[model samples]
Target: MNNFVLLEYAAWGISALLGLWMLADLIYTDRTYSEEMLTSSQEGDIEDSLVIDPTQQGGQK
Candidate 1:
């Protein structure tokens, strides 16, 4: 009976630890960028002409 109680306590401790680990992982997962940051990055790329086509530059085929 004492061994069974010890096993139960160990199982509960492991379960609680796993739940806490999962919660922490979810909470610290991604450092999401702001909308303003994304918009500014897109605008900077456009301003730099980073998406221009070489054929279009020569007035097409």
Candidate 2:
């Protein structure tokens, strides 16, 4: 096989390994944690904390 063909195979092999790893990690984490905990996020809390009144940034009209 040519160098290019061999490199292509290597790239595909690496990609397959990475995909498998992610899948396995997902399964392991799901089995190890609760659904609510897995899906829980602080996005709302973060958004609420960023309140910026326009008056605070500049002189009021």
Candidate 3:
């Protein structure tokens, strides 16, 4: 009987640990994805700004 009780507690502890681990992984994944999206958008903005207008260099010769 005592062994059964110990086994039950062990199972509960393992279950709780697995749940926490999964939650942590989900949060981390979401944060990483968001950062990557922000970085990519910022890069696009930089590229657009770098575009040059040849006509703006004062009428062509």
Candidate 4:
């Protein structure tokens, strides 16, 4: 019973440390998004152009 309790405590501690590390990384990371990066030719609808046929070559049988 004591061993199980210790293991559970250790697991919780590790999980908390990992969560804090991820939170810190997210807070410190610099991410930028710009509209100028996209070109006119890259702004087309893809769903209307994609064709899916399972019986076609390179597709699942």
TM-score per candidate, chains pooled: 0.48, 0.68, 0.53, 0.47
Clashes of each: 0, 0, 0, 0
Q: Please list the Cα RMSD from the true structure of every candidate, rounded to 1 decimal place.
A: 12.8, 10.2, 15.4, 8.7
lDDT of 2 by residue, 1-61 (tens): 9999999999999999999999999999999999998886555554463345557767477
Candidate with maximal TM-score = 2
Residue 16 displacement (Å), model 3: 0.2
Ranking by lDDT: 2, 3, 1, 4
Can you write out model 3's per-residue Cα lDDT over 1-61, one digit (the tens) per residue? 6999999999999999999999999899888787666455333454463344547656465
lDDT tens digits, residue span 16-37, model 4: 9999999887665523433453
How far out, in Å, is residue 46 in model 1? 32
> Relative to the true structure, how large is the alpha-carbon lDDT of every model?
0.72, 0.83, 0.75, 0.66
- lDDT for model 1: 0.72
Lowest lDDT sum, 10 consecutive residues, model 3, at: 41-50
Model 3 / residue 51 / CA error / Å: 34
Report the lDDT tens digits of candidate 1 across residue range 1-61: 6999999999999999999999887666534555565455343465455557657667557
